[model samples]
Target chain A: MKRGTLKSRLAPVALLAGLLLALPGAPLRAAELDAEQQARYQTLINELRCLVCQNQTIADSNAPLAADLRQQVETQIRAGRSDAEIKRYLTDRYGDFVLYRPPFKAKTWLLWGGPFVVLLIALGVALRFVRARRAAPAATAVDAAALRQVLADEAGDDARRPPENRS
Target chain B: MRLRYLVPALVLIGLVVLFAVGLRHDPREVPSPLIGKPAPAFSLAVLGAPQQTYTLADLKGRPVLVNFFASWCAACRVEHPFLMQLAAQGVEIVGVDYKDTDADGADWLARHGNPYRTVIADPQGAMGLDWGVYGAPETFVLDTAGTIVYKQIGPLSEAVWRERVAPLLQGAKP
Candidate 1:
């Protein structure tokens, strides 16, 4: 057999063997989740912040606190609690820091609304400049021509009419 | 004009100065949640004396410093000498063995020379959470009232202990 064909045939098997070897210490019969609950739990965990570790979502952090929080979520899921309830339970225990998207409040108003306000102000300023340029003499020549036509019509009316008494 | 640029330039410098001043505000000075509040309840078996249980109530009415550690935690080993120094200074030091076997914890204590008054074993790590521990080698300083006055995350340096704890020891709010 050609070496290339042999190596190609062996690659997938070797990968499978490596994967099996890597999981030797893993527990048999690992916790199983129903499809619906598994998807909900995954989405919930991805949104949650790992309070103990900096810059890691709860799903990603390996910190003990993160593990506890993850287990707590799993327990809530097993209990048939909704995702909101699970998040509320964790936030209650760990404070607002546990939330990745902080709730809009007096202190957090700027955090939530600052970007939109900045965009609106930028758009307003841009529109003002655009309007100003459009209103400039070169662009407003059409309006200037209309004004000239009105003035010329008045001059023609005066010339056509018998001269009004000098006033 | 050059002076127009100077105004924004000065404003930028002023903002930089303000930001620098804001950055210097230390989180350690913020009163810890564990301060003035009852120490969280914990009951873990003693690492060396396995049959005995170490509870938070056991250390009430005394100034105790609980050091959370693990045999595999390198920072814990780094700060071991500082803990010994704290012990020598008449501060009663207790240890919490975090997620480590009692045998390994005992061996580590023996090898490093134990400065702990009692070493609590948290083999399953339930007790560590009760104390709001994030990682290994976090030290909590408690007052005579059993309230946790300060918590030092990561390795405890002498400078941090002195700057953050000595004032609290002198009866100031952390």
Candidate 2:
């Protein structure tokens, strides 16, 4: 179905979280260092999203496909593939959706940049509001009757005074 | 003053429009990256008939529909009859039973009335990985050149067959 495609990739909040997770890190030992390789396994699985369960990472999902993908990831890790290479393997088949952390690419520019854009707009509006407040004095409402009373009192005072003084 | 209210209101409208449009989409249905690329290479024996085999290279001369199904997948059952209908109409379909035992797959097809021209077994689903299959009941349509023209993530209903797949098979836009 050629449904009208309107992606509400509105959550740059999630993107920010994913960004921290996706940041490049040190290389792993080639299938030998058991402890660090296991650590790397944990990190890789956590970062890779399960396509079947959309929200859950492969580490977290019980879906058969997720399990299979997890196995694939582990196999590749033991083969000494780098994290980026492993991610590339998935993104090749599944597109960028398999990564919990989306890559900074053409399609995802809005997703990564949307929060900062909103922040800038908000900051611009606040700056304009602050400058406007600083530039103008508060216009207090002047009651018409109070203005008339003041005028009448001044006039009466003028009448009571001598002609030269009034002039 | 009105513009101040109007700005937020416009932003709210934009959000509503976006979410409303988003609601119509099936999020689970991931569009395959394999589309517009050649179908993945594989050679697996037909489900019941192990002596015979099918491969991606063999499917090159004409348009074909490659469907991945399994005995365990309930969604595949829903689309089985329509697939049979297509088969009756001489639509060349290659059925790959993803992560299914040959015994169960053959029995399922026999009971359900085999719709496939040839049925292949993918007990481990390694070929599923190659084809970018995340779930069962995924279908891929290949052009005469064997390039994957389109991929249907879920069930292939008659409406989808008529509206989308049929036209594309004829080299026209749906």
Candidate 3:
């Protein structure tokens, strides 16, 4: 019984190890980012798109351009540049197209606000649906007998009600 | 039933929009900084034909296509026929041999039936970096004023040359 529990616990760990082993390609070489810098850089890279590949973010891509961008980010971090400054520098060199989360200005409002606008419309439709469903019962007539019984039950539940009111 | 049809219709519209955005992107027309800028000057000698030298100064009066290639490059081989076609169309072509031996460049040219008017050797790739060449077989089209108007990063196809380069030769601004 004890062995069974141990086997069940070890099974997932073994399975995970096997899966990692089955994956092709060697692991990426880890750069020297401290805990604070690592989190910051990770967040930054996730936001920045790889210029060459365009579709993939620098954090997710293994292209040479992505690697160069990663190194540039690390170097910038070590030099004490803020995230905003770094992003600005990259955008200046590679255009607004390089950014995955494009800036909120004249041209990119459509990209930024499109999803929220869609979500708001969806919410409005859902609310209307629920409201219409709630009003559906009102459109149908209630049974008189059932309504009377409900009223009687309510009257009986009150401590001030007499036995005649229970009916 | 109406909502079901509406869902599919919405999905279809979304898919169409997605496809439209995907296909709308013109990767080939990504503007080069070299556009409207003067071609970098170089007076390198043609490797095999030692007597012939190529320079930006010489190509000042007419449209010239500077094609950077290497004998060892596979993409350059793919573009060989297109280069020949361009030559057949009476396009003046200059070649920059990137990091290749003189004998190999000459033999490769001999085998490929040399399409270039002049070929210069850049065995160290110094000139290549100066011209912002990350890889081989990049072609730059220079106008009469010696300004680089178009830069194609990969092997140029006959269709691509006709679509992108030929118009520029006919006096298109970019």
lDDT of each model, Cα atoms only?
0.76, 0.85, 0.78
Please rank every candidate by lDDT, starting with the best: 2, 3, 1
Per-candidate Cα RMSD to the true structure, in Å, reads 9.7, 11.8, 8.2
- Model 1 residue B46 lDDT? 81
TM-score of 2: 0.79
**DockQ of candidate 3, scored on C-alphas against the true complex (2 decimals):** 0.11
Error of 1 at A104 (Å): 2.7
Cα lDDT tens digits, model 1, A10-80, are 99999999997886431211176687888887887788877656578878776666777677677789898
What tens-digit string does per-residue lDDT give for candidate 2 at B1-174?
A: 899899999999999999999998889888778889988899888787788887878888888889999999999999999999899888889899999999999889889998887788899999999899998899999998889988999899999988988888876221
The sequence of per-residue lDDT tens digits that candidate 3 reaches over residues B6-41 is 987998999999999979876633344456778877
Candidate 3 chain A least-lDDT 10 residues: A24-33
Would you list the clashing residue pairs of candidate 1?
none
**Comparing 1 and 3 by TM-score, which wins?**
1
- At residue B19, give the lDDT of candidate 3: 91
Which stretches of candidate 2 lie above 4 Å from their native place? A1-33, A138-167, B172-174
lDDT of 2 by residue, A1-167 (tens): 22423333545767887997796532332245488878888898889889988998888777888888878888888888998999988888999999888989999999999999999999999999999989898778999987786577577855466445532
Cα misplacement distance, residue A46 of candidate 2 (Å): 1.1
> What is candidate 1's lDDT per residue for B1-174, written digit by digit as tens?
697699689979989998999899743232234555678787777876768887878978777788899999998989999888887877788888898988898899889988888888898777766666667888888888788878887888899887987878776332
Order of the predicted models by TM-score, top scorer first: 2, 1, 3
Best by DockQ: 2
